[model samples]
Target: MASLAASLRDPAYVFHFLTPSFWSFLIGVVAAGSSLFFLALRADEQGEHFATSHNRDQINEAIRAMPEVVASPKRLADEANQGRNELIRQSHEKHARAQRAWARSQRYKVGWAASLTISALAFVLGYAWPLAQLSFFGAKLLP
Candidate 1:
């Protein structure tokens, strides 16, 4: 209780940012959170680490995409039927891929969530020190 109060009263003790302002800890939280979000986004976009993405793209390109050398359908009905089938298949494949990506991203999202929760707790503790003494808690929790 005294040290934080003293630091607040004495400008010299509170000069450094990392010591009190927690810039370094905040930076780590940002960096780690950004990386986790990126990984999650990447997974959601394309399951590069999994076979699902490769196969899905390949099938979509092969069957759904119109080729340069196009052929006229003997009957309009044939083209319509093929197009409908392709659309259905593509939608199913996309949904499956999305599910896989979402499952894969669970861990990253949880890690980021945990980091934020801990950071918030630490922030409270850092500011609450000068108001109340919790040496018993601090002794075990803080360095």
Candidate 2:
């Protein structure tokens, strides 16, 4: 047991501790988590858009239900049209926000995939390459 501990302290063997694979894997996991978080945010945004649309529909319905005694016919028509235009504008803005959130989630997903690929390549170079060198030449190629 003591000999095993002593061997672990050797510089060449300890090189494994400093390998890029561990760092890259951590980054990959963080990126994947970020992607998921953004995806949830995107869903929230879409739900907001749906709520906005519902509100707009309700506002339009209310405008249409206004009594004839409220104002002149032409004035009431103009007011109702204005209300509808405003509601449509608000709905469009909410939809735009949802689309932007979706775009952000997609970017994070791509980053996660890239980080994982880099981690895999780093593992091969940092761990496998050293072992191969040690087996064939009785010495590692890198520190």
Candidate 3:
């Protein structure tokens, strides 16, 4: 019984039994977490891209509609020139708004890309730091 107890307490045997499963579980968790994080980032990017594209389409439609608004000829001859000038001003305003929207979309793309890169780096480092440790001369050293 004493020998059985001593044999069961051996560190090498214990480590041999536990190490593979421990590392496997750790790696699996890291991989799954990284995959999920990346998927979320991709979903966010797609959503933003879709929204920006939709907004641009709407702006283009509005710009197209500006011509129709100016095509009405039911005004006095004298007022027609003033109406045309006002329509031109509105078209310029629409163009400015579209430019601003494009700039905002570009900013969003840059920010999202930066954030995704940082998050992926952090995840990789967190997983690798633990696995990169060296066991030598009865000491575990982080590499």
Candidate 4:
């Protein structure tokens, strides 16, 4: 308790406490936490996509009947439908490509695991480095 008070009074002691290992541990934890957060967002989006993908046909049909398209003159109705059909087809192709990419990312779970593992290692290094330094210098704990 005295040492704690002494260190608090002495700013130099603060530098000793903020070592490279401590910084590395802090960076690692923040990076890992961010990765986990993004991973969760990806999973939630994937779930929502999966739920909606099944209804894609119905969704496409609904889009085809947009107010502007439906309110076109009778003479232009056929032309509008033709153009809308082509647009919908292209959109479907793009959506399919996106879905494939999402599937690939989900299949590769190693990135998240690797980040967590590296952060854990950093935490261990941070905890051990100070003790190792103290031992090497034959420093006695201050009472």
Candidate 5:
């Protein structure tokens, strides 16, 4: 093991130790890419959930307005159109709320995609820049 120890102390051995190979760099790039992809997917899923909840709220509001709309339609229609007017107002409000939720969801999706893209790009550049270097002589020596 004395020979092995002496070889490890050599400058060539140390340099090789410091330098990484193309495959190692590729592995790092792949890992970063997968992580970014997962993050983007997660953000999209949350956005979908938000949209679904907003729709449900709108549906519930409409259902609640049903009984009032059915009760005394003839009289209510003439009395400042009470039930119909209220239903229309509630419908508009529910639509506005759903619109707002959709807008927020879209913003979240865009931000998540942008962040993931930037992170993946950074990782790729970091790995590729050093990988381009070609080692000579002691490059073949195994640490």
Candidate 6:
């Protein structure tokens, strides 16, 4: 425990860990994991939508109930058109929601990747600049 505390007080270690690079990398990893989790959630929702949208038992029952209406060729055509339209509308709504979820998931993924890249660059620049400055001045900047 004492040695651990002493190590924590070391300037080199402190400087390395305190840099933006390390922090950025940590945050980026978290963001990437979160995005991946959200993507899984979106995928699950899409499957659910597919299951619910494809179930046409209720529509079949409604269609089977109209014998007198079915007697007319015109009413049969209208019912068929209406049923097709209803299915199309439901499909459009389901697809739109799934697409929105996919878009959101992709955005999260992009953010995660960007954060990691920026963090790495920041770390490299931060770690190098102080040493480069000290070299230019021909002096020890830190003990």
Per-residue lDDT tens digits for candidate 2, residues 1-143, read 22332466464554453444446445556655665665566566556656655665675566567543345687776675675566556656755665665566566556556655655665455555445655886764334
Per-candidate Cα lDDT values, in order, are 0.56, 0.56, 0.53, 0.64, 0.56, 0.55
Candidate 5 local lDDT, 16-73, one digit each (tens): 5434433455555665566566566666655665665676577667767565433365
> Where in model 2 is the C-alpha error above 4 Å?
1-5, 8-77, 137-143
Q: Point out the worst 10-residue segment of candidate 1 by lDDT.
A: 134-143
List the candidate 4 regions with Cα displacement exceeding 4 Å: 1-14, 56-98, 136-143
Candidate 6 per-residue lDDT, tens place, 29-104, comes to: 6655665665566566556555544444444455456442343678776775676656556656756665665566
User: Which stretches of candidate 3 lie above 4 Å from their native place?
Assistant: 1-79, 135-143
Compose the digit string of candidate 4's lDDT tens values, residues 1-143. Answer: 22442456554554455456668788788868966975776677566566556556665776667644554577687676776667577668657855875775575455666777778888888767767766886543431
Candidate 1 residues 1-143, lDDT tens each?
A: 33543456454444332254455456556755666675666565445435665666666666656543335664655565676567558857776876667665676666657766666666665555533434434322232
Which runs of model 5 end up more than 4 angstroms from their true locations? 1-80, 133-143
lDDT at 36, model 4:
90
What's model 2's lDDT at 35? 53
* Per-candidate RMSD, Å: 10.1, 5.9, 9.3, 7.7, 7.8, 6.7
Score every model by TM-score: 0.37, 0.52, 0.44, 0.51, 0.45, 0.47
Q: How much is 114 displaced in model 3, in angstroms?
A: 0.7
